[model samples]
Target: MKLLLTAISGLLMGLTTAPFSASYLAWIALIPLWLFTISHKTTSLTPGVKNKLKIRNIIVNEKTLIAFIWGFAYHGFSLFWITGIHPMTWMGVPWLFSLLIAIFCWLFITIWGAILVTLWSVIFRLFIGSKEIGNSPLPPLTKGGEEQGMGIKKKTWLNNNLFQSISRVVFGVAVWCLLELLWNQGDLWWTSLSYTQSPNNLTILQLTKLSGYSTVTAAIVAINGIFAESIFVLGVNKKQFSLLILTGTLGIILLHLGGFYLYKQPLINDLSKEINVGIIQGNIPNTIKLYASGWRKAIEGYTNGYEKLSNQKVDLIITPETALPFDVEYIIKNSSFYSAILKQKVPVILGAFGSEKRSYTNSLFMMTETGNILSRFDKVKLVPLGEYIPFEDILGKIINRLSPLDSRLIAGTSDQIFETPFGQAITGICYESAFSEHFRRQANAGGQFILTASNNAHYSEIMPAQHHAQDVIRAIETDRWMARATNTGYSAIVNPKGDTLWISEMNTYQLHQGTIYPRNSQTLYVKWGDWLTIILTILSGILWIIDN
Candidate 1:
C-alpha cells in the first residue's frame, strides 16, 4: 500500500511537467510521499524489542527504497518518449536488437536520474526526522514533582513550534534545489522542477530573473512542504494547522504579485535593436541523412528553404542542426550547397559538421553575405550514447552498437559566443539547452540574444515539446529573446517573457520569419549563475548541523 501511494505521487509529479502541463498538480504531488515517511517513522514497535534491533537504520533504508521507487516512476513516465529511438533498421541494426537497445537506454537513464531524488530523500529523512511532534499526546500533570502520564517531567519541547516548522520547509526546499543544481552539472539532465510551471505559470516563471530556475523550484517545493505539514497536523494542533494553511495561501498570493510586477517591467531599452530573422525547418528523415544515396534530398530540403527565406530579404536566416549533413571541406569542394549559400544576399547561420585535424565536431557556422565564414560555435554538451558513447574503454565493444553516429564528435569550449552581423549571440546546440549555466555564461559575456539549433527528428512528438519548454525556461532565466530552429518541428521564437510568439508544426518543411530584439541588459541569474542555490545549500548544511 505504501509503495502504491509513492508511485501515484511520482506519476502526479510527472504530469506537472511539459507535454502534460498540469501545473496545479505540483502543489500536492509530494503529499503522499511525505505522509508515507511520517507514518513509517511513527510506526509502533514492541516496547522491549525496538531498542535491541537496529530500528533506526532499518527505517532509513526502507524510506530510501520508497523514495527510489517514487523517483523511478517519475522519470520513467516523464521520459517515456525515449523509446521512440527504436526501429534502428534505418541505421542497419536488427529489429529485435534495436528494440532492446531502446528499452535499455530508457531504463539506464531513468535509473541514473533517479539517484538524485534518492539521495535527497535520504538526507531529508536524516535531518528532518519525521516524528510529527504536534500529533503526539501530551502527558498529564500531577500534584507531585514528576508528571503522571508517562513518568516524565514537563519540559519546553512543546508541540508545533513555528520556527521549527518553517525551518523544515526551508531545509527541504533547499535540499531539493541543491540536488538539482549538482545533478545538472553531470552528463545527463532532462527535466527540472522549475519546468513544471513553464509557459503556463508565466507569472511565477518571471521570478527566475532573480536567480535562475531554482527560484521557481524553491517555490514549488516550499508550497508542497507546507501542505504536507498541514496534512500531518490536521486535528492535532488547530493553531498550527491554521497557521500553515494561512502561510501557504499568503505565500502563493505574494509570489504571483511579485512575479506580476517583474513581468510588467520593461525589458527593452532605447538602445535595443530588432533584427528580422528567418527560421527554416527541413523535415529530413534519419534514413536519408545517414546513407549516401539520400544526400541530395537532404541538401535540397535545406537549400530550398534557405533560398525561399533569402528571397524575403530577412536580416538573417537560421537552419537546424547538421542541416548540411556534411563536413565544411566536403561541402566547399564537392557540393553546390556552398555556392547556393554564397549567392544569397542575406547572411545565413547554418548547422553543419566542422573538421579540426582528424576530429569532427557538430557545429553552427555564421556566414557573411559575401559567403565568407564569419564565426563558428561547436556544440558543448553532447548527448550521452546519442552523440558519443561514455566509458568507451570499458563498454566500447558492447555499447558502441547502440549509437547511430559513424564517429564521435568532440566537445567545444564552454561559454563561446558567435559574433553576428546584428550583434553578439549565444548558441546552444540541441542537448545543451537543458543546462541553464551553459547559456548563463554566454549571456554574462555580453550575448544580446540566443540561437538554439536542434534536430528533433529522432524522437517522438513528446520530446520536441519538452525541448521547446526547456528553451522557454532558458529565455526567461537570461532575459533574452530566443530563436529556436529545429530539423523536424516546434521551431519557435520566444521573447524574454517566456511567450512563444511563433511556432511550427511537426514533420513539416516550414519557413518562419519573426523580429527579435537584442538587448544589452543582463538579469541577476546571468550575472550570478546558481548563486541562490549555493546559498541555500550552505544554509541547509548549517540547519542540519543545528538540528543534529
Candidate 2:
C-alpha cells in the first residue's frame, strides 16, 4: 500500500510538470513526499497480545518497505524519458551487448537517484535549521522527547548537515561560474585562441563567447532554487508555501509568454498574418551519419520533404542542421530541382553541409524564393565526439579502429546573423541554445529571433526535450523569441519570455506553424549577460563563510 501510494504520488508529480495548466502545482505535491519521513515513527504493541502485535509490526514494516520501493519506482518512471535514447542507440548492436548497455543505463540512473537523495538529505537538513530563522522544534529521536532516550550531540549533527548542504551549493555555483569565465574569456563575442596543432587553423570560438553565458546563468538558477528551498522550510503557513510556489512558477511562465506577445504585438502592428513553417525531420542513425554513404540517405529524406513542401503555400520552411547530407554548394549549384524549388519564390532556411575545399563547416543556408543563396550561418559550436574528437591525431589511430566514427568534422570561424526579409535571424545550432551569452550577443547584434536547429535523434526525446526546455530560461535570459527545429522530434516555438507556445511529439516527423514576433532589440540578459549568476555565487559564498 505504501509503495502504491508513493508510485501514484510520483506519477502525479511527473504529470503536473508537463506543459499544462497543472504544472505549477508540482511544488505543492512535492512537499508531501518530502514531509513523509518527518512523521515516520514505529509504534509499540499492547502487552496482552504480543504475538498478534508482532504480526502487526511485520505488516507495518512491509508497508514501509513497499513505500520506499514505490518512491524509487516513481522516480524511475518520472525520469523514464531519460532512458528513451538507450533503445534507439542500441538498434544495430548485438542483442546481448545492447541488453548490457540498456541495463547499465538503468543501473546508472538508480545510482544517480541514490546520490540525489543523499545530497537532498544534507540539503534538507540545512533547510530545517534556517526554515524558521533560528533554533526551532525538530523531531525527537525517541519517544516523549526524553533527554536520556538519545544522548548523541543533536546540535552537532544538525550543524554538520547544514554545513554540507551549503558547501555543495556553493561549490556547484563556483565551478559553473569558473567554466563560464573560461569559455567567454575577455570578449563577450568574437574571441580567438591559438590551437596546439594548427597555428593557422585559426579556429573561431564564438559559441562560448556568444552562448557561453550559461555558467553564470546556471548559478543564478541555483540561487533561486536555494531561495525556494528556504521558503519551503521557513514559510509560516501551508497557504504561503502554496502561493509562493504557484506565483513563482506562474510568473516565470507568464514572463515567457509576455516576451513573445509583446514582440509580436508591436512589430507586426496587427498586420502580421500567421505563417506556415514546415520543419523537416530526418531520422538518420548517428553511427552511420559519419560514414560516406550517410549523406545520401539524409539528402534523400530532405529532398523528399522539400518536394512535398514545394507545391504547398508555406511562407518559410525549416530543416534540421546538416539535414542536407552532402555539401549544399555542390547540390544547389549543380542540382536542377534544388534551384527550381527556390524559383517558386518561397524563402527556405535549411541545415546544410558546406565546404571551401580546404575546410568543411556545418551550416544553415537561407535561399530566396528563386532558390538563390541569400545568406549563410555556420554552426559556431561543434559536438565533441559526434562531430569531431579533440586531440585526434594521437588518439585517433587507436580510437578510429576501435570505434567506427568520424573524427574530422571541423568547427566554423564566425557568428554571422542571417539577413532575412522578415529580419535578422540568429542560429544556435544544437548545444548552442544552452549558452545564454551566445543568444545575448545575437540579440545585442540586432537579431530579431533565435532559430535553433538541432538533431536530437541520437538521444531519447525526454532528456533532450527537457534539456531543450531549459532554454526557455535562455529566452528569459535574452527576452528573444525562439523557434527550434529538430530532427526526430521536439520542433516547437517559445515566446521571448520563455514559455513553450507549441511543441510536436517526439520521434515523429511533423510540420508545425506559428506566429512569432521579430525585432532588433535587447533584454536584461542581453545587456548584463551573467552578472546575476556572479552576484548570486558571491552571495552564497559569503553566507557559507558566515555560517561555517
Candidate 3:
C-alpha cells in the first residue's frame, strides 16, 4: 500500500511536467510521499533494546526500496517518450534489435534519472533523524489551559513554533534544488520542476531572470513541502493547519507578485535596434537524411525555403541543424547551394558539417551576403549513443551497432560566439539547449540574441515540444530573444519574456518571419550563473544540521 501511494505521487509529479503540463498538480504531487516518509520512523536503540542492528537494517532497506519505487515511477512516466527511438530500420538495424535497443534506452535513462530522487529521499531522511518532524512531541499546555484526554497538550506543536515548519520546508526545497543541479551536470537531464510552469504560468516563470530556472524550481519545491507539512498536521492541530495554509498561500502570492514585477520590467531600454529574421522548417525524414538516395529531397526542401524567405528580403535566414549534411568544402565544390546563396544577396545562418584537421564537428555556419563564411560555432554538447558512444573501449562492440555514425564527433569550445551582421549571436546545436549555463555564459559574453538549430526528425511530437519548452526557459533566464529552427516541426520564436511569438506545425515545410531585438543588457542569472543556487543549498544544509 505504501509503495502504491509513492508511485501515485510520482505519477502526479510527472504529469505536472511537459506533454501533460498539469502545472497545478505539482503543488500536491509530493504529499503522498511526504506523508509516508513522515509517518515511518526509523527505530532507535534504547538502553535495553535487543537486535538493534537488525531493526536498523530493516528500516533502512524499507526506506531505500520505497524511495527507489517512487523515483522509478516518476522518471518512467516523464520520460516514456524515449521509446520513440524504435524502428531503427532507417539506420540499417533489424526490427527486433531496434526494439531491444529502444527498450534498453528507455529503461536505462529512467533508472539513471531515478538515482537523484532516491538520493534526495535518503539524504532527507538522514537530516530528519529518528523522530519525524510531523510526529515531534508536543510541548506542555499553555498557562491556565487544560490538558486534553490521554494527557495530550491543549496547545499544538506550532502554537509558537512556526520556525520549525518553515525551516523544514526551506531545507527540503534546498536539498531538492541541489540534487537537481548535481543531476543536470549529467547527460540524461531533461525535465525539471520549474519547467512545469513554463509557457503557461508566465508570472512565476519570470523568476528565472533572477537566478535561472533553479529559483523557480526552489519555489515549486518549497510550496509543495509547505502543503505536505500542513496535510500531516491537519487532523492533529487545526490552528497549525490554518497557519500553514495561510503561510503557503502567502508564499505563492508573493512569489507570483515578485515575478509579475520582473515580468513588467523592460528588458531593453531601447528597442530601436531590431533584425528581421526568417526561420525555415524543412520537414525532412530521418531515412531520407541518412541515405544517399534521398539527399536531393533534403537539399531541395531547404533550398526552396531559403529562396522563398530571401524573396521577402529578411535581414537573415536560418535553417535547421545539418540542413546541408555534407561538410563546408563538399557543399562549396560539388553543389550550386553556395552560388544560390550569393545570388540571393542575403545572409544565411545554416547548419552543416565542419572539418578541422580531418576531425569532423556538427556546426552552425554564418554565411555573409557575399557568400563568405562569417563565423562558425560547433556543437559543444553531442548526443550520446547517437553522435558519440560513451565508454567506447568497453561497450563499443555492442553499442556501435546502434549508433548512426561510424566515428564520434569532436566537441567544440563554448567560447565560440557567432559574429553576425546584426550582433553577437548565441547558438546551440541540438541538445545543448538543455543546459542553462551554456546560454548564460553566451549572454554574459555580450550575445544579444539566441539561435538554436535542431534536428528533431528522429523523435515524436512529445520530444520536440519538450525541446521547445527548454528553449523558452533559456530565453527567460538570459533575457534574450530566441529563434529556434528544427528539421521536422516546432520551430519557434520566443521573446525574452518566455512568450512563444510564433510556432510551426509538426512535419511541415514552413517559413516564419519575425522581428527580434538585439539587447546588450544581461540578467542577474547571466551575470552570477548558479552561484545563488549553490549558496542556497549550502545555507539550507547548515540549517538542517543545526536543526537536527
Candidate 4:
C-alpha cells in the first residue's frame, strides 16, 4: 500500500508538470503531491496493535521512501517535459528503448541530482547522531549549548514540534527558492557542457564537466530539498505559508504575463512606433538534409515564403535560426539571393552560418535593404554534442559508437547588437534565447529591441513552444519588446512587460506579421542581471551554515 501510494504520488507529480504552460501551480504542486510519500513513510510501522509506536522505524522508513520518491519525482516530472522533444518522438520504437532514453536524459539533469542530495541529507539529519547530522569533523555542541562544527554553528535548535515545524517550512521555502534561482544561473553552465541534438557539438570532457557541475548543483538543490520535504510534512497553515504561495505564484505569473504589460506601458507604447515585423516560419524537417532530392524543395519553400511576405513591406523580416542552412557569405555572394534581402527594403534578421578560418559559427546576420551585411553576432553558447563534440580525441570512439556523427563546432565571442537602418536590436540565435544574461547584456549594450531567432522543431511541439516562452520572460526581465521568430511556430511580438502582443501558433508553416515596439532602454533585471539570485544564494548558504 505504501509503495503503491508512493508511486501514485510520482505519477500525479509527473502529470502536473508535463504539459507546457500548464499552470503556475506546477511549481508548488510538488508540495502537496510529495505529502503522500511522506505519509506512507510515517505509517510503515506495525506498532504491535498500539503503543505510540516505534519512532525509529518511522524515521528509517521515511528516509528510504523519501529517497525513492525524491528521485522518482525529480526525474519523472522535470524530465517529463522531454517526451515533447523530437529525439524521443519515435514513439513507434520499442517501449523500453523510449523509456531508457528519456530516463537517461533526466538522470543527468541538475534537478534530479538535487533531489537525491535532499533525500540523503534528510535521512542523515533524522537518524544520524548530532556529529553525523552536522557532517563535519568537529564537536557537535559547545559550552553555549549550541552545535558547532567546521564552518558551521547552530544558532537555532528546536526541542518542540511547533518550533521545528515552523523552522522546517521556512527552511524548505528558502531552499526551494534558492535552488530554483541557482539552477537558473547554472542552466547556462550546464547547457554549455552537456550534449543536445540541436546545437550539435560536445566532447567527452565537456560531458564529464556537465556531470561535475551537476553534482555540485545537485548538492545545493539537495539542501533546498530538505527544506521542501520538511515543509510538505509539517509546515502548513502558517502565516508564512500564504506569503510563500502568493509570492511564488506571482513570480511565475509575472514571468508569463508581466512581459507585455511592462513593455507596452507609457515607456514603449506611447513613445515608440509599432513596427510591423514579418516572421517566416520555415517548417523544415530534420530528415530533409539526408535526401538529395529534398534540398531544392526545402530551399524553395523558405525562399517562396519569404518572397510572399516581402510584398507586405514590413519594417523587419525575421526568420528562425538557420532559416538558410548555408553560410552568410554564400548568401551575400549570390546576387539573386542578396536581391531577395534588398528588395524587402526593411532590415532582415535571420539565422545563418558565419565562417572564419576553419571554424564555422552558428550566427545571426542583419542585412540592409541594399544587400549590405550591416552587423553579425556569433552564437557564444553552443549546445554540447549537438553542434560540436567535446574531448573528441579520447571519447570519440565511444561517443561515435553510441551516437554516430556526433561532432563539435567552434563557439563565438561577443554578443553584438546589430545597428541597422531602422535601429539597433539585441539578437540571440537559437539556444542563446534561454540564457537571461545574454539578453540582459545585449539590452544593456544599447540594443533598442530584442530580436530572437530559434529552430525548435528538433523538440517538436512541446519543448520548442514551451521554451519559446523564454522570450516573453526575457522581454519582462529587460523591460524591452521581444520579437521572436521560430522555425515551426510560437513566434511572437512581446512587449517589455512580458505580455504577448502577438504570437504564432505551433507546428505549422506560416508567415506571422505584427507591429512591435522598440523599447530603447533597460529594466532592473537588465541592468543588475541575476543580482537578486546571487544575494539569495549567498543568504541560503549563510543560513545553511548557521543551521548546521
**Per-residue lDDT of model 4, residues 418-478, tens digit only:** 7766677888877776576777777788877888888766564555644554555556556
How high a TM-score does candidate 4 get?
0.68
**Global lDDT of each model?**
0.82, 0.53, 0.80, 0.53
Clashes of each: 0, 12, 0, 36
How would you order the candidates by lDDT, starting with the best? Answer: 1, 3, 2, 4
lDDT of 3 by residue, 1-548 (tens): 88888898888888877667788887777777666655535444555656656445544766667777778888888888888878888888889888987888888888877777777776676566444465354564554434453244334445434555676777777878888888778766777788878667888888898889899888887887888878767776677888889888999899999989988986663557778899988888887786685568777777788888899989999999998888887887776668779789899998988996657899999999998899999998887767776787875677555545554578898788789998899898889988898898889988989999998887888788788888999999988899999999789999999889999999988899988888887788888887767887787877666666
Candidate 4 lowest-lDDT run of ten: 193-202
* lDDT value for model 4: 0.53
Question: What TM-score would every model get versus the actual structure?
Answer: 0.93, 0.58, 0.93, 0.68
Which portions of model 1 miss their true places by more than 4 Å?
38-60, 130-134, 139-160, 269-272, 401-405
Better of 2 and 4 by TM-score: 4
Show pairs that collide, candidate 1: none
Task: Between candidates 1 and 3, name the one with more favorable lDDT.
Answer: 1
Candidate 2 per-residue lDDT over residues 1-548, each given as its tens digit: 54466566655544533232144333343333333322222233446756555554544444344434434554455455544434333335565554454554455454444333334333333322222322133445767667654555565544643454344445444543444455544211110110100111111111112223343234233443433434544533343345445655664455435433543443222236344566666667665665556666766666666667756776677888776655786777765448557556668787877774566777888887777788888776664433654457864553342223222456665567787667788678876664555667777888877778887776654555544554555555565667778777678787654456787777675666666667545555576665644775576667656665
Worst 10 residues of 1 by lDDT: 152-161
In model 2, the Cα lDDT at residue 17 comes to 30
| RMSD, every candidate, angstroms | 3.3, 12.8, 3.1, 10.7
- Candidate 2 matches the true fold with a TM-score of 0.58
Q: Residue 233 lDDT in model 1?
A: 66
Backbone steric clashes in candidate 2, count: 12
